[model samples]
Target chain A: MYDDRKYTEENMPKTGILLEVENTELKDINFGLVTAARDTGANEVLAFTTEELGTEAQNDLARYGVSQLIRLRTDSADITSSPDNCAAACVQAAREYGLEYCLGLATAFGRDIFARMAALLDVELAADVLQIDFKAKTAVKSHFSGKTMATVSLQETPGLLTVRPNAISPVEQPATLESSVFQADIQSQAKVAVKEIKTSDDRKMDLTEAPIIITGGRPIGKPENYAMLQECADVLGGAVGASRAAVDAGYAPHSMQVGQTGKTVSPNLYLACGVSGAVQHFAGMKTSKVIVGINKDKDAPIFEKCDYGIVGDMFEVVPALTKALQQEKQG
Target chain B: MQIYVCLKHVPDTAANITLKGQADYEAGAVKFVANPYDEYAVEEAVQLVEKDGSGEVVLVTLGPSEAVTTLRSSLAMGATRGLLVKTDEKFCDSKTTARALHAAILQDGSPDLIFTGKVAVDTEGSQTPYRLARLFDLPVANEVSALAINDGSAVAERELGAGNREVLEMKTPCVIGTTKGLNEPRYPKFPDIMKAKKKEIKELALADLDPALDPRPNLGKLEPVPERSGATMMEGSVEESVAQLIRTLKEGKML
Candidate 1:
């Protein structure tokens, strides 16, 4: 273990990306993935949490050419996430390393937790940044202000940014590196306790990170009929999305809803089934490379935003699309 | 019970916004109001305090003096008090606004619960409540549609995707970001509106809070949403339109 006292300011490398793992297993996964995504820049990639990085995650990180992994241990295993603790830790880390930027995954937990860190640091929290131009020293496209794209630069030290999950394609490279574990200064019990962990059984993937999304609106009519859209998503390896109108109308859950009021997504492919393509709904997913709209109303606003329009009953079209996917997969 | 509801004044949702030159559209010829979503937050706090039968609800805002309108609107909804932290235009962003709020909340002592809308229509940040929860070291439930305060804890149903729902039980001193389904925010009654005129609104300057936040996105330049072309009507029977649609879909390779 590197002594906190012995590690002086001059020797510490600049620019480290930190990730908190859900468990020791996830810690491994995060380090592995992060190391794989690392570049030739002279710096470090670290994962900090209650547990040490797993051997498998270390190996993965090595594959990606990461120089080393630093796992910071926490006192309690069941520490809850708080904006305060994260902010304090991040700010301390940034100030110590004289880092340029802090990067985080744009998960629901990250969005909630990192925004506070940005607030505490007195720097802007650039949410849902799709691409980071390291050479240009800029962040490209954050999710905010309704379906808009922006590139931001920070004159200040250690600007915080959250990366859209699928936006950065993870790559694998082989390397040889050592993994070191250290304890965090803040005790885990000092942080807020996560009261609960709830996972929806209906989805195989998280909506915010899904590469493909098939969404529906109130036009889908009944809640039970939503299964048809789910079938399409299942075949595409995507998650189901809903419009706020659909959620307010009792057709879907609020978590799945997307708009100015809900989650913003920029998947590779977005399919709107029975969604009228309201500006609010479009605002959430317009960044997608391809949009397909299936609506009975030929004049539905969604047709304008979509690359393809299916003027037909979503009920019939969705089943057929699912069947097509099944056939392609089978063949 | 002392309850505080955070409010923000925002551009009216109904305004026909146009893309003027580059940096933040020339925001002219548009109407503005207290953010519509925040109204629900204030209403929920007021209702919760009233349900308890003996409590005071306070409205707090970190913005310019113009934000007093938002505070007054909350008072008109039956809130007993108001606090406004006036600052430069920088407080317009959520991070700066949240820091200002943390300062105010710390000065005012602990609140049992903090409520905020899922996001403001102008800034459209759904992360502030979560961030605030972090700042206070409180548990948070984001985008909740329904909530029930129990003994020392609150049970809330959060909307998840694909018609899935998660009911999380959190302890007191927590933060919740409410969705539109929480309740129908009440319109200001006439009597309450008149009483709000006499309500004491404590206006604090930015200096008083010693704000500790950079109020910029710090990402890159802002760009406006592209304009939609005029609507096109398919002049044909439904079957003919479907044929044309299939043709369009195939041509676009969506088929």
Candidate 2:
């Protein structure tokens, strides 16, 4: 029941979804892509990238019989790194193939680049889509705004969508991946230029690339306590994270928030300390390799979701846990 | 370096989601205003040109012709000019709206920079800016908390999860969608308001741009969220309230 006009065979790929392979060494190419394709019906299917996990990542997609592997070949040296250019390349490929849908990782670049691409194509973009259903000539994506899931539909053709990275599971097998070269017409009246590139760490760990994450929430009480989370992250050799509530309340900066309005992460280990598990917050980190919740409230939602749960005062629990970890290291 | 700031006339953030028969709220009844996050983006564009003192700042919006009210507001806040991509009210989704902007930007020629809010308050779906960047194949920075431009280059600080930050550098002809922390947007002044009336405000349509591209994902069921019961004010001190709140969160499995 998908729109016949939008899903026409001429647009074989539908929308050309964009994914950037950044710091391949720090990440696994094993992407958990969720897409609503015309050939596959409306059921959300998984896809993979070739950057992080490499050819092995495609093996994971193979399991999803419906999965299609899109190997984005970038002139490694000419990488723009800007989301705008990355999106442009994707759009060009999509348009060239007459695809009706474009997808992207709901990462930092995904948010910034998709806005401009949607504007350029004059299409409404569904951001951080967690669930997508296509039926009766419409594509619906469920997302969270303030409190609840806001299901949006694209009534138009050639729509753009971005999903949180870990929202969908990566298929463990490969599909018949169609290969094509999408070379951007760099001379096409580009509105932006890359003047320079700078990284916070000449070799600093990327939050998304980290194996372990320690996210704090409003329960941290004050901004000063953020250092405590840092202390724990230091012990774990992980990156620090935050929830949107903590950021909006000024307990920490917005970049640190990890929720529906913030960043989605899937580290090998995610330690949510003093974080009250709001649905929005949970939506972002639900796919972590392993979860550990430390909250005084024994009934915390995180306890149900996490593999390990510790109910106690965080101020007392954190220092003791740090000391214990330190002792483990010393011993 | 001519700059364009796209603005959306949206509902205020404080507006509560009212329910209808425990299923859906009447979105039509919601009051709409210029999106707050977009205000910061518009402010950044205007401020960038003003601070640079060598470029023009133009504001753009794609709503009903009445969107002129929003466009004029941008002019009043020091935009050099404004463009209205007029369309029927029902075509307010990101795709059609973005087309109108692309048309206006194309007609206006290549601007050195484009700016928009991270997401519209009314729609609350943050994806248009990136799409536009892809279409134009321009560089972009989103949710930028801080920015600086000099000569033909610009620098921005992007907020990452957990007190983390990334600094980006881009050439001109970039797009920046901002969050609230970028800067405090200025209100309209009488002098500026008078000048805004005299500034040019052009109106165009989807047809005026390239043929309208087909839209993906048609919306089906529109329903409102269920209302929560009235919150109980805890008659206790901070310590007690924290404990009680923790208990309630635990009971709800939210803690």
Candidate 3:
């Protein structure tokens, strides 16, 4: 069955969603940007990727209502070699497509590219927004470490905005997919050259983008004990985190620390083990949809904020949960 | 070599931020300090000059008159001087801040390199370096965790999360927004502190900067984070609790 939209197809505003690829695989998060760009199911969505999208990536985005997928072409300059090159190329692609707004995830990669694009275009950027209101040309963003939320309007176009990853849920809206390539007329000076890229030893997803997070606090005795959380996180297809206490105590690196002093995360599920749920740690992850706390003390403050609580030793309880999740996964 | 570092005087992370009215926090109640992230930038710049053996590291900041104190604190960290762009507003969007900083940097002449924080702790608008770079037409990189300056070029390593590192080589006169793990900031010694108090800092009203535009309305509606209601705490044995947790997550389709 062919479905017709109430509005004229030619009259809809055009939006371009920049797809991110790592290790020759498209990040699953891009689909959410596609859903977000299809505001009210009328704005025509175009997906742009610096690299060629495989069949899997193409089908995934198309199911999210992406009407057009564009691969940027380059002559001598490699987009992967420089952020400036990618920014220049993407801005050119957006213009060639007549895109009213260019939207992307606010991941580390997206932030670098989109900010440059906004600067190159001389347009005010809405960076790291949590929600978008196309009708008013505005976005909602967190301020003061998530203590407050601010609404900002896009005052110009072709608009440049980056939505926080996972902030917008991906909706399956089927549309005929159109695939093509656009050669970017990049007038970019080669000021920056990429030397090398080294992946981490663990190579796990970043905490801010991980859908599920399993965090350990002071209780995990040694650095190696984080493996307990890691085992469970692996089963859940999530990332592991450490509280500020763990970092200060030299149990984990500052990169894995989750607190106002560390990374601010809003995951689908937050499993806190031995964490006290202090304001700083809480402030960093209070936006998580579901919080589950496990502590030895029945009255731990984490229980007050958690969606579920367990008064037990993490050494025993974590393994039990991991085993249970493993069986659940098998079943 | 001439190096410039951009600093911002922001509310301390520990300080409470209660709104005075709309878009304005209670200024008096919150203690202001050099943005902790910017401290990284200042430290990286000061270290660069120290390593070069012959160069000047200048600290540039935007804030009210009191912000000079923050600038001096950076100077005590071994910077040669300071440049303060005076503005009473507690907050300014990244665009205006970048424009003002661009103009202030030009006053000191074209810098060999510019450094700033990946994101200001207070406003957290992380686009200033890019915007400022555009105003200069130079290349820029943000969230760099490691860096080594070479002859008129720099090799910087930036964290892309998931433990991935992208090493880049940028030509001189570029902007860099540093993050944690770059370098440890040093606390100033007693004599250095006294000398920093006397360090030269040029002050200019943001208004005086080439007809700077008024602060844009970045905040249309500002309010506190919504209070979460009706938190649930599951009971019973460890296995039972885990089962209940799984059930709820599945029901919500968050699993």
Candidate 4:
């Protein structure tokens, strides 16, 4: 635990990053969040985890300037069973650690808990921010389908922020670490009855956190045809997405949608296959660093917006792209 | 089935937007509507009451006075009435938004369930429903694509992304943050629209909720995201294009 008594400097606020677990292992996205929570050398980073990290994981966090590992738990209830339960645990940690700022990824699970924590603490919350100014207690986030960037200034102590995944790359700065467990005390009454979590069969990576994304649009035509993009996405170490038209046509589910109404992504590389690149669709992936558009129509709007374009049928290009990427990997 | 569906008046998602200055988007001539996701929540609640044959589905919102116009659209879809917590400020913080709605709901007494859209379209906060759930001490589920209320509990199938669903069980008097695919919202008929305009819309001030409220978050500059330059088109066959794409990926260290 960071002793606030030892260093009461006004500039050095206590910062905490909520670590996430995927398939029972630490998620890579936490490294960027931890690096950000370090406040560019302004904060002593604290990593809050539900379960105790192994020596190797602790070492990994230490390299990113995480000085302390706090294993949040409750003696009265299980935190992992439900989001509210996890939130309650985090709330107790915020108070216990005297956290001035708390950060987490803006993924689905992160959104569930941080909002709960904000309400429980009666503090202002900022979700899915793209950039943070820790000293000012402010963040810059996109609004109105990523068309505008709004900087929100939070006033409350322990200001909560759920950062967009991959918004920042991980930076290494080694620090000695202290590991501790915080047992939260709370009432025994359970509000939510958390049941089974049905995991996906083919899609293992979360779209928002995926470094690369390959999306299918209207011309993909069939639900089964998404497999072609999936093959390409796999070779690229990425995830698959669908435009609003594809999802609306029932060729894909709303969960896979990437558009004005769907999930906004900021992947490093975005491949738009057969997507017409409507304003709504472009709004979602606008922040991507590099975009490649593949469409049969040479005049597709995506061609004008993307960094690279190929006028070809996705059916022919996607499979060939997948094979090429695979061979590049082997060679 | 006493249900409350929280609503937000927002600019249409597909509307062209221009900013006046910091945190201010020029609202002039922009077609405002009931938030798209909130429409799904209102739809679910109305369908539940319609199926039960006897119940009230109240619509609650916190925004400017003009928000009632948006609220009436939900009323046309068959809500019992509307509660408008008026705020002149266009970009009110979520904390203030949630607290006001919590207070306003208790005015009519606690209902059996509280429903909200998973996200507000303009802000895309995705926080109100969860914050309200915490303030009300209720179990909440966000991004819910499918929901069934039965025997004092809800069996909600929440979308967990990447084609997975979480089947959760929350007891009655809980909160549900509904999203797209939850249900198809009904368009109000001409007769229903006329009837909705006549429906009661009770108004309240922000101060009425809490006399000495906490300081709210403020939004700074609203600037447009810079546009991307035009693409570098690749010519020749599929194999050639694929090769060029691979070469670019390798050069950029993206492979």
Residues B1-255, candidate 2, lDDT per residue (tens digit)? Answer: 688888886544445456454224545666666777788887888777777778888888877766787777778888888887766553255555665687788888778889998776555677567656666766667787888887777788776533456777777677788886798789888998998999999887756666664333334444443332222332243344444533543454422
Over 4 Å off, model 4 = A1-12, B207-217
**Regions of model 3 farther than 4 Å from truth:** A1-7
True contacts kept of each: 0.27, 0.24, 0.65, 0.83
Ranking by DockQ: 4, 3, 1, 2
RMSD of 2: 8.1
Q: Among these predicted structures, which one has the highest lDDT?
A: 4
Report the Cα lDDT for residue A111, model 2. 65
Q: Write the per-residue lDDT of candidate 1 for residues A265-314, one digit (tens) a residue.
A: 87767888888877777767777656777788878878776766667787
Question: What is candidate 2's local distance difference test score?
Answer: 0.62
Candidate 2 or 1, higher lDDT: 1
Minimum summed lDDT over a 10-residue window in model 2 chain B is located at: B226-235
List, residue by residue over A1-331, the lDDT tens digit for candidate 2: 7788556433444434454455553133224543233235333332323343455434434444433445444553233544444555555556665655666666666666666666656666777665556454343333224433455665555666776555554434334554334445543333444444444442434466456778887888889998887787787677788887788788976656676556657666787888877766765676665666777787777776666656667786667656655655677
CA lDDT, every prediction? 0.66, 0.62, 0.84, 0.86
Q: In lDDT terms, how accurate is model 1?
A: 0.66
* Backbone steric clashes in candidate 1, count: 15
Report the C-alpha lDDT of model 4 over B131-156, residue by residue, as the tens digit: 78878878888889989898888989
TM-scores for all candidates?
0.79, 0.65, 0.95, 0.94
